[model samples]
Target: MTVATTDLDRLKSGADQLFSKKKLAGFSIPLVIIAYLVYIFFAFDVPGLYSRADMDNARTLVADSYSYKMHVTRDNRSAEVDISIEGRRNGTYPEDGSPDWVTRGEETVIDLGQGHIATFGPEIVTYTIPGYGTFRAEPGRSGVNATFPDGDLPGWINASKNRVAITTEAGRFTVTRNRTEVFRYFNGWEAFWFTLDSPYYGLSVGEVAGRAVQGEAGDIFTAFWTNSMWRHQDVAWALFETVLMAFLGTFGAGLIALPLAFLAAKNFAPLMAVRFAMRRMFDFLRGVDALIWTIILARAFGPGPLTGALAILVTDTGTFGKIFSEALENVDKAPIEGVQSTGASAIQRYRFGVIPQVVPVLISQLLYFLESNTRSATVIGAITGGGIGLLLTQAIITQQDWEKVTYFIVLIVLMVMAMDWISGILRRRLISGDGTGH
Candidate 1:
């Protein structure tokens, strides 16, 4: 009985120790997490980032994504005025005219709505705001000479000896010794379906449809398809190039990895050295990201879709090799043995036994990679200058083509979604053994 009592006391002591360790761990885990978070917060300069953020620029960028602007610029030296959409040459107004809001005579009068008027004379520009009164600037040999209302200049107007700028809800105006410019913001994409030069520019949808019924469909489509600003034809081709990159990369990787996977699998490769070499090769491939590979390949082959495809192929080959080796290792041995008993050669045994067992995994992984690669190809294309990514990069670089950027972004998203759907369907059908439609 004394021995039994001692055993119970020992069990109680052990339980108490376990509970103490558990309690300490629970408290320590939270403290460690909090400490790490505090370190990250200071290391990343969270407060500095907040101070550096420009909310006004952010607002303007967001606005530009969905809107367009009309530029009315006058060369002060020659007194020549030109009106264009977003200041693009193709979107310039015809010689015959200007918008209804602008009136031309001895002087050009621009009505900026809500009683805001800007008039450009031979060497002077005048802007009148309803409650703010009139402001004028003249470009001379020295600089832009300016006059304003009696009170202190509002914060919206910035003036210096060489330049004067006025910003209002209606529009913006800037005057310098070289030029006088006015910008008017408007909602929606400009020249989306047809440019100003197109004959079909001002047609209503119903009118366009009637024209189509009357055999003008080809002309209308040609105009839209060849739109310079939007570049519909170019965009379509870019999307195709992107898809091609993903296709070649993913399947090429799969093909290259399949055989190599056997060399890595311990069950198939009897030599430990060969298995280790193959595994390390895979590690090397997947370890250095695809972007690094793209840069290396671009140097060798020059930038193009093919180079991007090769980079993806190399990276995914390693990944596929690892996955395929694992799948091969886990495969059932019964089928392999059964095929061997039938006097099948090594290659034939693998074909009839190993392939059939892993076909589903192979197809599923291949299709998933194909889908994933489609998105990867876009980033790769940006580096290679071959696909929609090229156009996207160009738009971003322009800094004024946010609308185009938005359009390209939308196309990219749609392209990825379509690829995802296609891959999903192919995976389901192939895995279900219904690929032949029987």
Candidate 2:
């Protein structure tokens, strides 16, 4: 049945009022609800996720890790003990690592007020209490007390940095880390500062204290000191190789994608039919991850740095094609129209009107891509036997040596940070038109 004109008008008027407020209200309720839900999702969790035992152990671990001996005291009882350590096991502590394998955990409660003298041959330890004076023993000795001058014990707790040192009759011996004990002279165990406030034994201390120094010659401390284990030549060549790979890959990809991005963008392309298809093609290439491409490339090309860098180039081309075309589409049309009004050729119009406007953007994108691709190169290096990463993978597998891994990782991190800084400077220069005229 046909509705009356008045009824139809009433129905339309009610519908408009309902939609005007409800349209925005529909979105508002969900927004507020979702925001509240998200807040709940992150703000709370299962109770006591970290067990009491874990916290106790972690505190013990941290205290022990820093060489601080922990003392427990309450209700007329006191116990002091050391915690276990964390680090690459280079055997730096005199405790378990030494030539005689002798860790002389020598502790003495001495009064600086009393005088006592002690002496040993070349490998003896001697300390004098102020008034009590001197006493001596062989390389290995236990608690031998000097007569207290009306005193129960001395005040200072003479704790070795980690182990006891053997001194000569003259009360002094050189602390050296040399094979064969150099019994000719003694070198004190080495202790080096880790942070501003505290110090820990250096690798040499572990080497010498363990008496393992005799078995292993030279200084472990010196070894850990250098920036790169590689000779200067290898470093120079490897650096050249990395820079060249990035340049060649980025240059090749840019050349291939610049035109593709133009054709893919509707603003420049007359064929709207092809534009959507090309845009989808661009998306397809960009969808595949870089590391995934690296794996495929490594398999097909045989693993190498070139294969790794090329993988980055292949992946980046698709991503940049999409980015470049969008940049192209977003270009100011005033210049393009002005050029067209003069009846300029297509190539000339693009060269004069489009490229100049977008060159800075393109360069910015390229530089950003370069920075991104460097990390990709390193990951690829891990998979494909390239750069320091390949060496790192090998080192980890061969020795299970976390220290060496730490060493390589530090280098990689520093390199990445340096590259980022360089890229940021170049990007700023390009955008601000301050780059040396290219």
Candidate 3:
């Protein structure tokens, strides 16, 4: 080796030493800055959290129940129904089959067999049967048959059109027929639940109930939370939209960032001066927080996934450009020189020698940016008025407690973790270092 030593070897060794020192110096400030930022970000909490009233509000929002009101409408229809009273053991239609009515102690039967809740409106006649304390609302339908003993007929019940009023002895309720209406009892909305849901004003449930079930939406639950409460389908759909926003935002940004990176690379750029300018521009772009970008985009385009995506795209361009250019700069000049000595064109030199060396770095950087962007997307979605974060903000503002707040937080965390794991795997396989991604 002492006999064969050459000038090229010395130049290469000196360049490596210089590179190592410069790299170490460059990383120092970034590492310190990152450490400080992570510390502050983790420890920070909303100022509103300190107030007792705010804490109580948050708790109330999260602790709320789940109930919903559905609007139903129908045209005029009536069918006579039979009312009956019998013990659990055995029963038969009474002999005479007259409209037998009963009181708390009495029993009655009618020609029309037992009816459903549809018949159980306030106008419908009903009275206690001897053994069963449960009130029954039989929808009024004409020409049905059953028999009963005598008492005062209650009134014409029509639960179909009014707020259902049903009373019954819990232990003993069964239908002789597999009547669908009878099954309705099992499916009927609970009275307590009615107070928890949002009901729209134009619907009969709200009109009869006095106040809209939810407010602002002008539905029932708004009033009810004002008074106990609960709330998922619509929420889930909105959440789904938020996830979509993140996906599109990240994907679109990656498309633009990839090419800009090559141009920003000092090894690939047409001129050294141009490369320097582009590198500085990239630094400026990435230095600006994604959230700030989102705000700017939202103002330019209005609230939408486009703003979120543009923010990611704009930010990622800076990030990828820096990474790609660094990778280009660090490339082995020996291979490039070998290609050039062969009289290869500039493009051909890069294609054969430079690209192969940097491909791994490009892939690793791409994966890293994609992973980072997912978390950024969530944050941008929140502040820029798109994605699950928007609704999450509402939940926080409304002071819903642990459950509602936990719901979105859990989703976001899981998504970020999944992204990190995937990126790590890709980076390990593609990048030169023996890092976790492998």
Reference-based TM-score of each model: 0.91, 0.51, 0.47
- Which regions in candidate 2 have their CA more than 4 angstroms from the true location? 1-245, 341-343, 434-438
Ranking by TM-score: 1, 2, 3
Give, for candidate 2, the lowest lDDT window spanning 10 residues: 70-79
lDDT by residue for model 2 (112-148), tens: 2123322222343345544454433222223222222
Tell me the tens digit of each residue's lDDT in model 1 across 190-291. Answer: 899999999888789999999999999999999999999899999999999999999999999999999999999989999999999999999999999898
Look at candidate 2 and tell me the lDDT of residue 60.
37
Model 3, 1-438: lDDT tens digits are: 664577778888999999998999899879999998877766674444466356665433443323211211111133222322111111112333322221111222221225322222322333334433334433334321222234433433223333333334211222211121221111122232333222431246546455433234344444433423223444555555555655565556556655666777766678877777887889898898686787788889998667887888887778767777777778889988998999999898878877788777677666776777777666777787776677678767765333456666877788778878988987776665632221
Highest TM-score model number: 1
Ranking by lDDT: 1, 2, 3
